[model samples]
Target chain A: MEWDWDFAWSIMPTLLAGFRITLIATFLGAIVAAVLGLVFAILRRSSNRWLSRGTSFVVEFIRGTPLLVQLYFIFYVLPDLGLRLPALMAGVIGMGLHYATYAAEVYRGGIESVPRGQWEAARATNLTTRQTWLHVILPQAVPPMIPAMANYLLAMFKETPLLSAITVLELMNQAKSVANSSYRYVEPMTLVGVMFLIVSLLSVIALRWLERRYGRVSQ
Target chain B: MGDWAGYLTLILQGAWVTVKLTLMGSALALVVAFLAGLGRISHHAPIRWLSTAYIEFFRGTSIFVQLFWIYFVLPMTGAELTPMQAGVMALGLNVGAYGAEVVRGAILAVPRGQHEACIAVNLTRWQRLRHVILPQALPLMLPTFCNNAIELLKATSVVSLISLSDMTFQAQVVRSQTGSTLMPFVTILVLYFAMSSAISFGMRRIERRVTRGLDGVR
Candidate 1:
């Protein structure tokens, strides 16, 4: 029960190795979420009713379910359907896909914050839709969303532990393996908790800086 | 089809466990949310600091780590918790940390006029909070509380890691038994979505009923 410094020291390398994978998963997953979320947001706003509605339903369904279950489906079931993926890849994709729905909402909120006059002005200037979006709208819409998007980044970072459920050898999984072998739960579990706490606190500090710099979207 | 029905029944039993965990976890979370939330704004410095620390510590760590620590580490200290108890405690404390912020924000959002009116009427602090502040704040908290409850529901799936026979865990059982990976996972996903949608729908109804006569409020 007592804290074992020696044992903790020995396991540090393994845990850190796992932490590296965690960071990589989180980084790749964030990219996927950011791009796909933008796509979903845009699709939901499309003039075609079916496309908009379908995208909306997809977002809702994804948002409603647990990431753990999604990860399970990807890791365990997909191979049966002839689309087998490595555990890390599946975890990253599952993480990205689940969080994309949340990120889509953030994107939608930012896009909506753009003024109606801005759109009309784009049309008035005879700017092509692509030029209007690329030059005028997104430039305005995206900056204010940085802070909110970063919040999800931290959320996704914390959720990286769930990636362990799919056997991705992330920090939680690494810690569990150590615990199972050594029969010393206190050290590994405590270290893992501390590691997450330190990163989360630092991320929160960074989030505050982001909020200050970006000036959050008003309401 | 008969065997499929049996699998469905087993998963539904697991779904019942999931519902129980959600309800119990949410109940504990509500209490923790109010106490820690109000504590964050307390007159006493130590109480405020304690509340802030509790909120931050719980919020800063992921729930999965917290659950594992409670289930595995705590037993070393001689306080062994059943898997169900650990799940409820971890989910409650984790979501409660988030809910505390919601509680604090909603309470703060109450108009200054209400507090001034309480003072003018010479209402004691307890009376002011009970009658004036909380009544107005409750409606504001409900929407976010609904979201947090759904978060709690999703979080219960993490308990399956600790060997709790919740829906996600049961899906694994079904998968192993039936050798149909797709059906078990797909079934649970639908069940989870249904539960979350129900939570949202129920919360909206409660919100409507609460805000009925409070025009210009909420």
Candidate 2:
């Protein structure tokens, strides 16, 4: 019932191990979100009406649903349909796809902020569509996006706790297991909360630096 | 396939609970948002610091950990709470922190001329805030508040972990009873989307009414 420093020190190793897994899942998930979000943004802007509308609908549907349920579906239901992924893989993908919808909105804003003249200039230079996107548009668009993208990365990190639901040994799961076995809820749970708070505050500082370095997207 | 009506009825009952939690959580969040937001801009330094600390603490931690700490740890300290109470507190406080920022931003966005006019008219601080400031800022807060409400709804799904028998929990129950994983999840997903869209639609209507004359400047 009281604060126990010795007990907290005893569980430090296990919690740190769980913290590593949490970091790994978040890192990989950010990569997946960044790439897939770009795809969603580009697809929604396609010339074909069906493609654009369908892409937007899918993005909205994903955005609307809860990521916890999505993770349950991916980890439990998909295996029934002959797709079985490792628990970590399922967790990372669920986090990535859920956040991709948000990141897509950020990317759309960044891409749109590039002036119409840039597209015209690319065409004037006789560049192909692919060349224009690669050489001219994205370079200008991606820099301003770094700060917003980093914000989602930190959000995804905070969400890693949900991975515990699907049996990934992330920080929350580790803390829960420690509490369950040792019958000491206070230290483990408090440690988990403090660890998360520290990391998130640090990331906010880093995000501010990123915004200053890369320049923020004007909303 | 078996007893389709029974399954639908059970899920609807759970959906009702989800709706209740969302409504209760949002009401609590709105209260916290206003208090903290106003506190952040207060002239008193201690009040401002305390508000900033509350906002940062809630915003910095994951909602899951907060829920666990409230549900599990509090009982140990002899402050027991029902699952519903715990879920509402966690959801409200978490989203309320984010909403406080929105409230602060909207208040700051109100034109300086309005505040000057209040000073010229010799309005007290309370009068200035109630009659002059809030009416203008309320319109700007509506759209962002709608988003926060939807986020709170999505977050209610996390309460299923604590055996609250909410929509997501009932979906899990349905999955076990019917041996069908996909249908229950898909159904709940659609239900969540409908709820979110409904909130957006209702907020837009309110937004239009509130901003009826203000659109000229905004």
Give candidates' CA RMSD values in order.
1.3, 1.4
Q: Tens-digit lDDT track for model 2 on B18-109?
A: 99999999999999999999999999999999999999999999899999999999999899999999999999999999999999999999
**Residue B195's C-alpha lDDT in candidate 2?**
95
Position B91, candidate 2: lDDT: 95
Candidate 1: misplaced stretches above 4 Å?
A: B216-218
Best by TM-score: 1
lDDT by residue for model 1 over A170-215, one digit each (tens)?
Answer: 8989999999998889999999999999998998899889999988
Q: What is the TM-score of each candidate against the true structure?
A: 0.98, 0.97
Index of the highest-lDDT prediction: 2
**C-alpha DockQ of every model:** 0.90, 0.86
Stretches of model 2 off by over 4 angstroms after superposition:
none
Per-candidate chain B TM: 0.97, 0.96
Residue A210 displacement (Å), model 2: 1.4
